[model samples]
Target: MNHARKVHIALNVTDVNRSVEFYRTAFGVEPVKWKPGYAKFDITEPPLNLTLNHQANIEGKGALNHLGIEVSSTAEVLAAKQRLREAGLEVIDEMNVDCCFALQDKIWITDPDGYRWEIFMVKVQDTQPDLTVPQGQHLQACCRQ
Candidate 1:
């Protein structure tokens, strides 16, 4: 929303090769550059500069809560779910879910290295959650992140 045109994320992975494969399926794009212990994906679909680094001892690698790609429509989210499922990856679809003071339609997936990623589009912003379930059944408003 500022002057930034692309978002860059450098990840520490236990195995670059495996992470590359996971990302390839997740983003539906291959790495533009690859080298020993490193791979880079210059993605255009989401305008991301994603890189994978081989970390011999990356303790709490998955501790980095989660990553996400925010799309513009629910249809795009469904399309992503379809594409990800076709790639043999496990996808968790959560539609019309309220979280973080907003409602969204999203899908979740885990990479080979335990990184949780989501593809989501916000539906309603700055509104309180309003589902029936309670206590861990759904994500409550905590303003996380």
Candidate 2:
């Protein structure tokens, strides 16, 4: 038997309305479901489900951790980049970048609440030895203490 499941990601925000507006403008989609203090957007084209909830305090909640959306092709990633830039959101290009021992073409952006989000296409997966530079190469270690 083959089964499929939907992915849902919930993000806490100070204001649901503001977050909704940002997401709507950025993704070019409206939330299919919305209620007081809660909203759900079913991003159709990319098949992502996003939920936003109002919360006064998110500190120490691990809410700032990064999340990513992987697309099928590099062109899609570039399209998203253009859309995001046109919406006046801060879009960063990390094209042909190497991270976690894999090569990817990606864009990184931060939401209103400062959570890092990455939209990327995996160009190739690395199987060779890690090429990451050693600590202190850039005057400090890359990894945190």
Candidate 3:
């Protein structure tokens, strides 16, 4: 079928219930479908089809550095921050921070599985010099984290 205007990501989580709760809070919406070991969230704002699959013995980082939604305006970012806060999740804010070659206003939320989700708005866009990483350092360090 036509899948335009949407992005799909399936994540393997150790706990289905916990992931469902986390995503519900993060997206400000419940899963459109939920089963014993699977949950799917169809988010409209950013048009995402995110699914969580219950899996044991997850190896490696499993969770990546982070996932983010680029909002249209700062107002939208603030609204998202408010919604996540109202859901009783600890939200961290990064205002006017230069990251990823752009000036951004953003907030961060961590799921129980240690996956980080960022809600941000691009305030200014410009070419930024390439950043070099030091030995034994991770890419996250240069990401304005």
Candidate 4:
């Protein structure tokens, strides 16, 4: 089987500078490339690529549904939460939470456009037989209820 490589996430936003500031404060990194209407950050210490683009109708488009970043340990997750809070950003904690048949410790935040983002540490992987059902059910159930 071919191995999957790196993943890049492109996010559309209303203002590049504001989004850049939010991400920089939240993730503790600076964009490697930045221009008038675009910015890109290599969040590889956490192994993720984050890109931001400026557009007029970012809110109307609903460009970002939600995205997740998984860290190495629960301490890292809590640390991230504290950092965000210190920057005057709201961070939602969901520790010991069951989702997709596995237990996770996580924190949630939203960007300026109200796009949900999750930073988490996976403590256990579930060996469930019905993967699809569990995945869908968990996403719906966990956030709402």
What is the lDDT of every predicted structure here? Answer: 0.66, 0.63, 0.66, 0.65
TM-score of candidate 4 on Cα atoms, chains taken together? 0.49
> Predicted candidate 1: what Cα RMSD to the true structure?
13.8
Which whole-number lDDT from 0 to 100 does residue 38 have in model 3?
A: 53
Instruction: Give the runs in model 1 whose Cα sits over 4 Å from its true position.
Output: 1-63, 129-145
Supply the TM-score for candidate 3: 0.50
TM-score, each model?
Answer: 0.49, 0.48, 0.50, 0.49
Q: Which residue pairs collide, candidate 4? A: 44-47
Instruction: Quickly count the clashes in candidate 4.
Output: 1
**Residue 137 C-alpha lDDT in model 1:** 27
Any idea what lDDT model 4 has? 0.65
Tens digits of per-residue lDDT for model 1, 15-116: 677787899999999876555555568698778867675556668555243566767788888999999999999999888886544587889888998777
lDDT of 4 by residue, 20-64 (tens): 889999889987656545565767566675667555675667655
TM-score of 1: 0.49
Clashing pairs for model 1 are none
Per-residue CA lDDT of model 2 for 119-142, tens digit only, reads: 766576542333343322211111
